[model samples]
Target: GPDLLTFGEALVSLRSAGPLTAGGALTPHLAGAEANVAIGLARLGHRAAFAGRVSDDELGTFLLRQLRAEGVDVTHVVRDPGRPAGLMFLERRTADLTRVLYQRAGSAGSALGVDDLRPALAAGARVLHLTGITPALSAGAREAAGWAAETAARAGTLVCLDVNHRSKLWSRDAARAVLTPLAGHASVVVASDDELDLVGAPGADEETLVTGLLARGVSTVLVKRGGEGARAYTADGRRDAAALPVTAVDTVGAGDAFTAGYLSGHLDGLDLAGRLRRAVTLGAFAVAGHGDWETLPRRDELSLLDSRQPGDTL
Candidate 1:
C-alpha cells in the first residue's frame, strides 16, 4: 500500500521523569495520538502521512521538524495565524505511571474543518486512521474527522478507528454521538475496555461488545486490555492473544502503539490472531522506552521481544 493517512492533533510536550515540583529531566518531543501512529508506521517502513492544523508558532515548527525527522509526510500540516499547536505536560510516576496535563483549547488542530482536508489525502489514501480525541476537540474538527472517514471509505480505502476514550476532553453523551456514527463508516474499529463502557456497548464480554460494533457496521472489532492481551473479532469468529511480558515504563502512548502495530499487520494482510499478538507485543515495546516516538521499534527490532520463551532469563 502507498498511503496511510492519520488525522489528529500534534502537541509540543514537555516531558519529565518524575513529579513536576520534584524536578526531573525536561525533554521536548512530539506528542499526539495520531502523530504517534504516524511515526510508528514510518518506523516499520510503511507509508504514513499526517493531516492536521498546527500553529505557525514555535511549537508548531518543532512538531513539523519532529515528524519530518522521522520520515513522516507532513504536506497536509497547516499553520494558523491566530492559533498555536496544543501543549501537554508529561510526568512519569515510578516506572509505570504516566500522567498528562493538557492545555489544548481552541488550538489550531482543534479548529480544523472539512474544507481543510487535503485533496491528496482524500483521493490517494489506502487507510484512514482516526481516534476518539479528534471529534472532542471542536465542531470543526469533528466535522473534518467524519468527512475524512466517509471520503476514505468512499475511495475504497479501509478505515480504522481507534476508540480512545478520554474523559477529560468531553462528555459521554457527546462522545457517543460522534463516535457511534463514525464507527458506522469503518471496516475495523479498535477500542479498549474503558472506551466500550463510555459508548454503552451491549455488554462487558467481547462477543456482545463486538456484536454491537458490528451492528454499527464495523466488520472487525478489536478490544485491547493492557497486560491481558487483546480480543479480535470478524465475520468468521473471534481470537485472542496472550500478553507478552515486559517491564512497564510510561503508559502514555501504548494504546496508540497498539493501533500502529495492529493496523500495520492489517495492511500487511496478517491473520486476525497474528495481528492481535503483534499489537500486544508492540505495545509492550512502547512501554519499554522513554518518550513516545523515541522508543518505537522498527520491523527488525520488533522481533526481539518474542525471542524469549517462558523459562528464558532476561
Candidate 2:
C-alpha cells in the first residue's frame, strides 16, 4: 500500500536550546530512528507509513501532526490508553558532545508486541525498515521486530535493518546476541563503526566488519563513519563517499538521514556510487540543521548545500 513501511518508537524530544548549564529553554521535536527515515523518505517524494504506539496525550497529538505534516501516513499508529508517550532529552555541552537521557522505560512504545504487526500494515510495502533499538526496548518489541522482518522476507520485500545500539537499553553482549540474527535476515544492514560491536565485531576495521556482516547473509553493509563519510559494500563491489564540508550544528539523526538517502537511491535505481554520494549529502544536511529531521532535504532542496554564485536567486 505504501512505498516504505516502518515500525518503531516515536518519542517527544526535549532538546536544550543552549548548553544545559545555561539553558534558556528546551525545544520539543519528534525523534525516532524509524520515524526519521519515514520522514526523510516522504520528503524525497515516497509514500511512507509509520506504525507505532503513542499515548493519548498532548505529546502524542503533536507527534501525529508532525508526522502527517512530513507526509508520513500514520494510519497504523495506535494510541495507548494508559501509558504516556515516551520522551528523550538531549543536552549539548559542546559542539562534539551531546548527552541523551530517556524517559521511555515502560512507556507505550516499549510495550510494542507481535500483535501490533497487522498483516495489512506489514505487507505490500516495497521495503520494511527496522532498527536494533526496537528490539532492545523489551522482549515483546523484539518479537515484533523479528516478526516484521520475517514477514517482509517471505514477501520478497527488502528488509532494511539499522543497528542503532543504545547502551542504556541493553548490554553489548545481549545486543549482539539479538541483533546478529536479525541482521542476517535483513537485505540491507546499516551500522556505525562503533555500533558494529553490537553485531559481534568490536574494534574491527571497516572492511573486516563489513565482511563479517556480508557473511551473515546481508546483501549490503553500509559502514557509517560519521565525519569521515560512509562506505557501502555489496556482492558486486564496494563504494565510498567522503563527507561534505559543512559546519555541523547538531550531529544527531545524521545517520538516519544517511540511511534514508541510500534507500531513496535504491528505490530510484541509482548505481552504488550515486547512492553513496546521495547518502553523504543527506547526512551533511542533517548535521547542518538544528534539529534531527528538520533539515532533511527534499529532491529539489538537495542542491541547497551546493556552492551558489554570488548573484543567483530563485
Candidate 3:
C-alpha cells in the first residue's frame, strides 16, 4: 500500500507550437493533475499511487507505461474499452502564455464512478489527494470525489483538496456548489489566490476567506500565487514563501508540482516553513522546463537547484 493516494482524470496531451487553428506539429505527452502530482511525489521518493480510468487503447497503454516508469503505483487504475481516451491540446500563444483546450466530454476518465474508489486503498493511505477538476467531470465523477473525501475523513486519513477550478468544464456557481462541500472534508486546501473564493465565499477578501476556511475546520489553507509566491494559513499563524527567481518556459502543471512538494515535505515531517520552501522549489523546477512532470527533481537532486547560480553549468 502507498502512503499517498490520488485519483482523477488522466488525459493524452498534444502540444502545439502555436495556435491550434494555425495547423502545426503536435507532440504527445502524458498529462493529468493527479498523475502529475503522483509522478512528482514518486520522483521525490514517496509512496504515491494514482487511481483513475483510461481507455483501453495505445494512448492508455503509453500512459500506464510512463507512470510505471516513474515509480507510481497504478494498481487501481481501470481500463475501459467502451469509452475513448480524453485529449487536451496545449497551444503556446506566446513566449510566456499558453492556452489549453479540452476534448474530454464523454471520455473514459469522466466515467469514474463511486465503485472506482477502493475503500481499502483509500483508507490505507496516510493522505488522499483530490482536485476540483475531478468533480467537474461528470455527475458520477463528482459523486466519486465526494465519496472518497468522506471515506478518507472517516478513516483518519488526511484529505487534501486542491481547488483546481476549470472554467471550460463548468460554471462558477456549479463549481462553488461542489467544491465548497468538498472542502468541508479536507484537512488541507490548496488553491490559487484568486480561487479562494470558490471554496470559501464569493467576492470575499483574502483574509476573510482564509479565516472563514480555518473556522470551518480546515487545518491548513495554502494560497498559490503564480509569480508572486505562495502563502500558508493555519490556526497557528501564516507562513509565506517567495517564488524562486527562475526563467519560466511553460507555466502549466506548476501548481501540481508545488502540491507534490508540499505533501512530500509533510510526509517527511518537515515544518511549515520547510514545506513552503520545498513547494516553491519544486514549482520553480516545473516552470523552468517545457513539459509538465519532465523536469521534476529526484529526492537527492532537490539540492541541485540551490547549489547552482543562474545560467551556470553544473
Q: Which candidate comes out best when scored by lDDT?
A: 3
Prediction 3 global C-alpha lDDT: 0.91
What is the Å distance of residue 121 in model 2 from its true position?
4.1
Supply candidate 1's per-residue lDDT for 62: 89
For each candidate in the order shown, give its overall lDDT on alpha carbons: 0.82, 0.88, 0.91
How many clashes show up per model?
0, 0, 0
Q: Which stretches of candidate 2 lie over 4 Å from their true place?
A: 19-24, 94-96, 120-122, 201-205, 309-314
Better of 1 and 2 by lDDT: 2
Q: Which stretches of candidate 3 lie above 4 Å from their native place?
A: 119-123
Instruction: Please give me the total number of clashing residue pairs in predicted model 2.
Output: 0
TM accuracy, model 2: 0.94
Residue 14, model 3: lDDT of 96
Candidate 3 structure quality by residue, lDDT tens digits, 1-314: 68899999888999998878989899999999999999999999899999999999998898899999999998899999999889999988776678999999999999999988875354479889999999999999999999999988988898999999899999888999899989999999999988999997899999999898898889999999998889999999888899988888888899999999999999999999999999999999999999999999998888777756778986
Which 10-residue window in model 2 sums to the lowest lDDT? 115-124
For candidate 3, the per-residue lDDT at 72 reads: 95
lDDT tens digits, residues 1-314, model 1? 35689979998899887898898688888999999999989899999989889999888898999999998998877788899778888877555667778889989989988877866464577778999899999988988888888888888889998888778898777788788888888998888866774444533565666777777778888888888878788888877787778766666788889888898888788977777867887798887666776888888888777767645666
TM-score of 1: 0.92
